[model samples]
Target chain A: MRNMLLLAQFEVKKMLFNPRGVIALAAFSLVWLLILLYPIRGASEFLISPDYKALIEGLFGPEVVSELFKWSVAELAIYWIAALYLFPLFSIFIAADQFSSDKARGTFRFLTLRASRESIFFGRFIGHMTIQTILVSLTVLATIVLAVSREATLLMPAIGSGALVIVNLVIVLLPYTALMAILSLYANSARQATIYAILIWAAMSITIAIINNYLPIISELKWILPGSQISLMINTQGLGSFAYAPVALLQTLVLLLLGRIYIKRSAI
Target chain B: MRLIECKDLSKSYGSKQALKQVDLTLDAGAPIALVGPNGAGKTTLFSLLCGYITPTTGEVSLLGHKPGDAALLGRVASLPQDATLDPNFDILTQLILFGTLQGFSKKEAKSEALRVLSLVDLAGSASQKPKSLSHGMAKRVAIAQSLIGSPEIVLLDEPTAGLDPANAKKIRELVRELSSKTTFIISSHNLDELEKLCGQVLYLELGQLTQSVSMDDSQQSQYLTLTMQQCDSEKLLNGVMELADISSIEKKQHNEFLIKHNSEEDYAIESALFTLFKQNSWQYKAILKGRTLEDKLFS
Candidate 1:
């Protein structure tokens, strides 16, 4: 267990210390700033205005207005809306090279000399998850800060919901990270791994839709893709958001198991 | 103690069989040499021993544990041919990580990394990334990583392949210094180097273990090379043959002869050869016991 943690710690160091990793982090920070400036910061006042209530009713219908009003802090609401989809997409890129480049460079041969392939695989998986967790925490903390700066009394409430938001967002990104673990095993590069993820996602959706069209009984097969729970997950608020956690957990479990099996049989 | 055991070990890539069914047992000892021509399955066998790839058939046991088993984590280390360290991290960081993984604390790992880097004469380059180092330097760093924790069994594939003469000699000296405590299985094409470093040789040909020889065994070390001053080759061979206990004689050059004899004493053959040289008025240049490793393996 100690060895596995050391491997995980080194994996994090590898991603952060590499020039490419620093560049990726810089790009993410730039995009995040743009998000904070335009949609999140710009729309903050509008979320509390009467006009905003009407716009929500017009766009999402009157029924959603009541459900949306539960979110008193505008920054947290907007952050959640943006983060639900943004994080999982960014995760694919962040985790895509978990194994591919290392395997290609033959570094695993050095690592596996002291660690097992299983430990290295899961150690890297844990490392990617830890990185995603930090990114999520930073963005969430930013949202919470923005919320409290505008209305000091919203501090306690924002902190309460921000913690919940972090947990749910991490759960949603788990399968995406795990999916990369599986793709990285076969991909020769991170770019190739991302391409494989996109191809597999599109193919999976198309194949399921085509199959479901002829056989309606198999409509539930849509859950096989990692993103199947995102749509449902985005609609829930507060404690209700925990409902789809099982689906994401199941997907992560299955994908990680598949990755482990494939890695065990693979040549380093 | 038996250090390595292989039973019906075989490996194939699709339709091409890289290693056929072969059984081998290696005991704990000084360094052993794994020698073969290209496409002779030397790397494949090394990979199996290191547990980088599973064998298609049979089993491999290293230090009483299956290759790649967690039990053998700190016990067995290997320098796989062409395998490299991560280019992103500096040499010390990677080496320290390897040490910590093998159960060293951070402080201990750092010191161990430094020790091994010094062993390869790259302790000063510990802070430099792999890309900054030349190929030979990077290769030595890779070798240094394998030496971390002073493993009981170290398998090096082509340890001196890219090294210059000075660096190669240093590595040979390092192996000699460490051989008393660590068992090394070095696979290389340099016969002369192996002949100096190894006590046993595992010779493979076309995926088969054709011969497993001791460097000091009678058949390999019993012959002598006689270099005489310019003389008639037939006359030189005839005079050498006239000596008793002469098993065979081959005229290697116009004035050189390789004589294989069944004599129990090397001095007895030398004394007789000295008399034969005087009878033919051939002044001797040099007499060397045993043939070159190249001659032993190929000739």
Candidate 2:
């Protein structure tokens, strides 16, 4: 436990303090800030609009669509979709260098001398998750503050929705971070690792689409891909929100184990 | 005591065998020099001993425990050759992290790192990023980290390979000072420096252990090399021919003689030859006892 925490501490410091980390965060914050300031600010005006209501209803279905007419529900729904889609995409770039950069520079040579291979891999995985949690939480809090400021009665639901979004975002991040960590083991450079991660995702998504069209029964093979449960996670409300939680957790553990095994078996 | 025991230890990467089966035991305190050519399994052996890679056939036990055992955390340290520092962290930050990993508290780790940085004469460079430092500076920092917590055994592969003369000398001096408490297995192509620092020599050739002898035995040889500026092959041989301590003298080259002494103490023989050379007004370079490591290993 101590070893894991120490490695995690070092990993966290590296992410927040390094120049590359700072640049990535600054860029993400700029784009995230624009979304929060522009579209999120107009949620109250849009919730009262009848045409937007039909459109929201058409997209999300009548079950959750009526809830979208409320300001808190609309902000949560928009942010949930953003978190489902955009956050995982952002996670890949942010996590691209997590393990590969260290392996490339031979830093793991020093680390393995003290910490076990499992500690290093899991510690890095948890550290990346912590950062993503903080990012998602910040955006969720911003959404809640905007909703409560408009209609104070929406505070409780906004808080409830905010928590769900945070959980969903973190679940979405688990497999993506673990996938990048695995790629880092084989990729020669951080840039190559990032590009390879994107290529793998594209390839898997394409394969899943083709399978879905030809053989819908076997389309469940899509679960093999990381973050394949994001749609199920976002579309389901309350009890259904956690439907794919176990699968995401399973994929995270499996990828993390594979990464640890690779580092252990290979020569440092 | 950190005792290193290897029993038929072998390693192969698929079809290519790196280290053949070998057995050996080494005790702590003496500085052992690992002398080998390129592709001679020097780095491979270090990796196995440091637990960077596992052996294929046998085992390596350090301090009576397997390498990389949690029990050996602060007891064993290594300076891997060609391994660069992380470019992001400053030297102090990374070194302190290493120190802490060995079980030191944060404050204690910082203090240990500062002390080691001073030992390597890089006390002022602690705040410098690894990429900002010179190659030699980076190597010294690597050495400094290995010295953390006064490890019982240190495996240094080419510790002074690329350092400047002054820095190299400092490293040699530091190793010499630490030889009393630390068991160091240093692998380097610099035989002369290795000879000066190591009390024992272990030679590897073609992934096999060819020679293992004490440096003391290397110095106790009957042969001595003499270099004189105005030395004549015949004259120098004649000059020491009748000396009781001298058995025979052969001219290796101009101004050089390989003296075979008559079982006399090395200094007595060298003293007699020095007196003879002084009488003949023969200017000389140096009279070194025994063949150098290069001559013994390579020749």
Candidate 3:
């Protein structure tokens, strides 16, 4: 347990505290700032306007659009559409090279000498989650503040709903980040991991679409693409906040287990 | 008690075997030198010992536990052949992280890093990034990292490979000083340095340990290399031939002779030769014991 924590501490410092990490985080924060202050705020206003209300109702169905009047739930609709898609993209760039760069530079030679292989693998995974939490927290805070300004009495409920938004968004990224961790094990460098991440995402999406037509029985295999259940997690479809949480958690555990096996046997 | 035990340990990558059928048992607190040519399995053996790689054919143990086991967490450490530090962090910060993994508290870890830096003569370079330091300085910092938490078994592969002569000598001295507390398995191509530092020598070739010599008992004192003035060579050799302890003498180099005596401790022969050289007015240089590692390996 202590070794795991120590590895996590080093991993966090590598991804969030270094100069490159600082630059990446800075750029990400700027993008999130724009997201919170502009489109996110604008989407809420436009969806409720009479000109677009019918359009949104028709697109999303009247039952789902009716919940937008409730301040606690309205922001989730905007937050989901804005943050959920952007979160996975943001995650790929931030954690693309987490494991690969260490191997490329021979740093793992020293690391594996003292710490257990499992500690290093899981520590890096947890460390990526930590960055995910930080980014999520800041974005949610800005969105809640914007929601509170437009409706003063909605502050308390906004906090609760905002908490749900961050949890759901973060959970949705876990399996994806876990897959990236696995990618890094095979990649030569972080840059290669980043490139592989985008290519793999597109390739998997195409494969899932193509295979679904002929092999409908294995439709559930689409979940391997990561973030496939984002809509289920955000739950604009009337499922509970945690309906997809267990599946995401299960996928994350399975990917992490595979990573542990690979790292143990693979040459550092 | 055996601090390390390996029986028929072997490792292979694809068809290339790095180590084969190796066997060894060692106790604690003795500095052992590993001498070998490049690609001679020195690094592979160190990796297996430190748990970076597992043996393919045999079992191995460190401090009576598996090499990578948690029981040996603070007890074993290594200064790998590669000195690549994370260019992002300063030396002190990295050492603190290493110290933390070795089980020191944050504050204690910092102090320990500071202490080790001081040991390696890099007290002022604590805040310096690894990229900012020269290869030699970076190597020292890497050495300092291994010394953290006062590890009992420290495996150093070419610890001073890139250092200047002076720094290399100092690191040797540091190893000698630390030998009292830590058991060191140092692999280096510098036989002279190893001869001066190590108590035992293990010669590895073609993925196998060919010979192991205990340096303390290496010199049998029956032979000595005697160097005298060029003009006095004949006179000194002829005079020394008269000594009662002498068995045979051969002129190896100009004014140098390889003298074989009758006993392991040739004190009587040495004293007799001193008198003979003084009488003949020959400048006597050094009268030393049997062959060095280089001589043994080459011969």
Candidate 4:
């Protein structure tokens, strides 16, 4: 247990200290600030153009105009999309290189002194999750600050929804992170694991769309893909409705289990 | 009791066998040199011993515990070949992190990190990241990391590979100083370096243990290269060969001979040869030197 904690702590420190991680976080925050303060003047104009507004209302209902008006600092924050996709991308970049790079650098043998495979795997997983939480929190706080400063009459109708959104986002992202971790353990090189992960995700996405289009018998397979589930969760909640948390939880658990099994059986 | 023992261990990757029915025993308090040419299973053996990879067949035990059995790791520390440190971290932080993982308290990790870094002569680079240091400094940092928690078994693979002559000398001296307290299995391509620090040598060739030798068992001799005068040199050679305690002789050139004699009895052989030269009224020149370990290794 102590060894696991130490491994996790080191993982966290690595992410925090890495210049690429720091720069990405900084860049995301800057973009969040721009989106929050100038949504109508800038971003919302592009998303809420006459044609888009028609499409929005046609899809969501006429009240989406008011929904657009109720966009809080949190709503303008990109973390919702960022956490769903961008955060997972960063998680891949941070972790896909974890074990393979260690092997490449010849450190995996040395690291075996500190802990066993089980501890190293779970410990790094916890550390990466911690980093994700911290990055998400920072982006959320920055968005709230920008919202409060720009909009003085802030009752923030979607504040509760925004919090739920982030929670669901994390839940959806966990499985993908676990899968990437397993890929990292199995691959001999970071590039190979990353390419494998991206290709898998792409194939799953295309398969989900194709299944959704024609297959009545296995159309439910679409929900198994985390990306499809996440899109459903986002579209459902974005229009002021709650998603099925149990389904999301179940998918997350399966991915985590698969990841653990892969890591346990992996050679390195 | 043996601190480590391996029995018919074998490992293969697909079709390439890395280790083949290898057997070895490491006794307490003895530093063993694991010497081999490139791709001769040195790293593979270390990996199996350290529990980074499981053997395809056979068994390895560390102090009576199986390798990779969590209980065995507390006493067994390994410095793998070319192990990389996290380049983003300072040496102190890197050490502290590893120490803490090995079950040291935060305060203990800090102090031990400082002490080990200094032991490796890397005190000045404590605040520097690994990327900023030279290859030799980074290697020392890796060595420093393995010394944490005073592990009983230290497995160092090519520890001195990239070091400069001075740094390599320092590391060799440190290994000699530390040998009394810890058992080391160090692998190197440099036979001279291993000869300087190891009491026992294990030579691996083609994934098999070909030879094992004890440094103490090889006797040192006083060797001489002599030039003989032309008084029928065969009679002179024949006369020299007839002396007692002369170990061997080799003809190096038309008129020169290389001679070896037990050091304690060298004087007797030299005196008898000198007497023969005077009686025969022959002329000769001789220069003597101490025998080296390399000569024995090849011999």
What's the lDDT for all of these models?
0.88, 0.82, 0.82, 0.73
Candidate 4 lDDT by residue in tens digits, B1-299: 57989999999999999899999987976689988789999999998888877899999999888887888665788777667776667779878877787888999999999998998899888999888999899889888888898888899989999999999998888888888888888998888788778888888877898888876663434676667765676776677777877777776667767787764753676777779889999887654443334444555
Candidate 3 Cα misplacement greater than 4 A, ranges: A59-75, A231-239, B227-257, B263-265, B271-284
**Where does candidate 4 clash, by residue pair?**
none
Please tell me which model should have the higher lDDT, number 1 or number 4: 1
Give each prediction's root-mean-square deviation over alpha carbons.
2.0, 2.6, 2.8, 4.9
Is model 3 an incorrect, acceptable, medium or high docking prediction? medium
**Residue range B1-299, candidate 3, lDDT tens digits:** 68889999999988999998999888775699999899999999998988877788999998888877878876788898774878899988888887887778999999999999999899999999999999899899888888888889999999989899999999999999999999999999999899899888999999999988887673456777776655466666677788887887877667768787786453777788777767766776677677656766655
Chain A alone, TM-score per model: 0.96, 0.89, 0.91, 0.78
Candidate 2, residues B34-140, lDDT tens digits: the string is 98889999999999999988999998999989977878877888898878888888999988888888889999999999999999989999999998988888899
A1-268, model 3: which lDDT tens digit per residue?
Answer: 7878778777787877788888988898898778777787887888667778788778888776565544444555687777878888888877777688778887786677667888888888888888888888988888888888888887887787788777777888898889899998889987788888889878988999888988999988987767788755443522355777777888889988899888887877
Higher-TM-score candidate among 2 and 4? 2
Off by over 4 Å in 4: A38-55, A59-95, A150-159, A187-192, A209-215, A238-243, A264-268, B218-240, B250-299
Assess candidate 2 and give its TM-score to the true structure.
Answer: 0.92
Q: Put the candidates in lDDT order, highest first.
A: 1, 2, 3, 4
TM-score of each: 0.95, 0.92, 0.92, 0.82
Q: Which ten residues in a row have the lowest lDDT in candidate 3 chain B?
A: B228-237
Judged by DockQ cut-offs, the docking class of candidate 2 is medium
Judging by lDDT against the true structure, name the best candidate. 1
